[model samples]
Target: MTTPPPNQNDIQNGAGSSPPRQQTVALVDDDRNILTAVSIGLQAEGFATRVYADGETALKALLENPPDLAIFDIKMPRMDGLQLLQSLRAQSALPVIILTSKDEEPDEALGLALGADDYITKPFSQRLLVARIRAILRRSELVRNPPEDAPGDEQAGTIGRGRLRLDPARHQVTWNDRSVSLTVTEFLILEALAMRPGVVKSRNQLMDAAYNDDVFVDDRTIDSHIKRLRRKFRSVDPEFAAIETLYGAGYSFADG
Candidate 1:
């Protein structure tokens, strides 16, 4: 398959550009054939690649330092993909894509919820996958260091919950003057959910915003994290349980 021309903006941005050095990709899958094929395909596209058979090994690698992008399989022998995603989100918002051989709804929904930037069903074409990788990479580069003069300077770094305050820069969350300690992922997820208040975001969308697609994650992973977030909020203010779960849909931060 013919490769699309390199993105000009991505090259100019230089946020994570490796070009001649070859971009690196972490591929985690239990299937040796799939892993080898993906690694070979990515290598053909000038990406340096690392392959892992399970989540535990992948997580260990990430702990030292994560790759620019990770393509993770949902079902693995150990430390399932969803758990790995949660672990990653608990600390860092790495760009991640969920790949699954099964096309089940639960898998899709859960992966999105866990903070996967994107999900690709199995039997996918190499070309489409490559394009998605490029697009995600370009977006990540842009987000890492947005242009100083970019429009909407006033809108940058503002986090709120109907009048509730969440100062990201200060790492503070308050409602009527009481502070809260939320995990970094929880904070970001809250920020995204609260931004539109009442507007429902699918599991996939929520995952994308919090993790920003920088890490490979699973959707069900999102459900587990949200459960943790709800528990924390319930501990502080019982009435502050406004994170509504829309069955068959996703979730919406209730309007205050």
Candidate 2:
């Protein structure tokens, strides 16, 4: 008696247990091969994927119906990833990761500065890409559903220092009662600094607080984020000097 192959329903339902809810990921790239490969991989990992070949289409679909997360190729035709990100940031705080090539470091930096949560260079390992996606999703989930019994301002999902107020749940920041927008990564970095005012935080420390442990971001990434953070705050208040940079050391938040 030969054993029979599993049916499609059996496989989908794991023979007995029910399938878990699928998280949706939007993959926007000009490369069909990349889109297919990534979509297949993410599907295998129990995620639902929506693929678009250009930034314009992706941007339209994303705004019409947002996904749990988004990954974009920086070299897309039409609007391009950076432009799409700029447009999206103006309306939504959606988590976005940009894909770049080795030679597109400047574009990658610009994407991050523009509000992308993370970036991966082209020819990246699928495992690493998935890890980054998972890490970002985890952070997003945490922000959405904070622990009810946790202590501290972070637990309360709101922190304030001086005139700066951060609401993790709402993903909102306000300085001197003026609303200021920040990327997810930027918010985490600012929250860490504001949590311990006057305490210097090394680049590594900031990265740990802002990004997943598995993500190995460069020092320049932190610098770019900090630079953008300062710019955003300073735009509202030119005298905003709460973020003090310590050369050869790190950064500190002014207590007063």
Candidate 3:
């Protein structure tokens, strides 16, 4: 006789073979059509999704049951994307990607300044969205589980330049012995700079180092990240001046 398929519990317990648990993504948007379409696309790609119609609701649910990643729409009612981003940043460093409409460059810049990891304008391709999500998640995973045989696989796994200390394995940064919190993107950007002190890296070079090639990031995005990076370091040490800009060129990390 033919055997029946394994039940959910049996599959989960490995009594029968099954794919690993799918990562969950929280999709926040007031547009029902967009929400449904994106949710379907994400689910098709082996991702479980939680959908919300407004920012306030999404924020509550997200904090209560955090997901692997989140996507927010800039024009949501009750609580817009920027406000939700602000609330989320206050408590967690959950990787976030914001959605904006065409001609909303200012909004995009503001979102990035407020700690958004990335932003995509409206009318974006679904495939493009998926690619962006995967890129961010990939970075997050790397930060969580660094390579066992990383170039510097020491007990501390830390890199230092002057007063700045970076621990790639721990995904931590310290300045003058004090801890400083940085978003995954910010950490990557700073790491690239600190890796080669006094070496000016062009915007394209920094972008290549920080993000996957599939995701298209403009020069302003890099500039915004640099600005936030400096702001964060300055907050910890008022006289922080390690990052320097070269007009008509790019940026370099001072060895001081």
lDDT of all the models against the reference? 0.69, 0.80, 0.80
Per-residue lDDT tens digits of candidate 2, residues 1-256? 2222221111121223335555778888877677767776776777777888788778878888888899989887798999999999877778999999899878876887677888898799889989899888877864445566666666666877889988776666899999997767988999899999999999999989987665566788889889888988899999999999999889999966
The C-alpha stretches of model 2 lying farther than 4 A from their native spots are 1-21, 142-157, 167-172, 176-179, 213-220, 234-239
Q: Higher TM-score: candidate 1 or 2?
A: 2
In what order do the candidates fall by TM-score, top score first?
A: 3, 2, 1
How high is each candidate's TM-score? 0.58, 0.75, 0.78
- Residue-level lDDT of model 3, residues 1-256, one tens digit each, is 2232221111112224324645778888877777767776776677777778888878877888888889999998899999999899877778999999889888877887787888888898889988888888877865545667666625666888889999877787899998887888889889999999999999999888876665566788899889878878888899999999999799999987
True lDDT of residue 73, candidate 1: 87
What is the lDDT, from 0 to 100, of the residue 39 in candidate 1?
Answer: 69
The deviation in Å at residue 124 for candidate 2 is: 3.4
The TM-score obtained by model 2 is 0.75
Better of 1 and 2 by lDDT: 2
lDDT (Cα, tens digit) per residue for candidate 1, span 1-256:
4333222112122235556545667877777777767766777777777777889888878656666778888888878887888787666556778886655657766776666667788888999888878766764543334465643313656466664676654445776466665644566677788889889988888777766443446666778768877866666787776889998789888868
Which whole-number lDDT from 0 to 100 does residue 109 have in model 2? 66
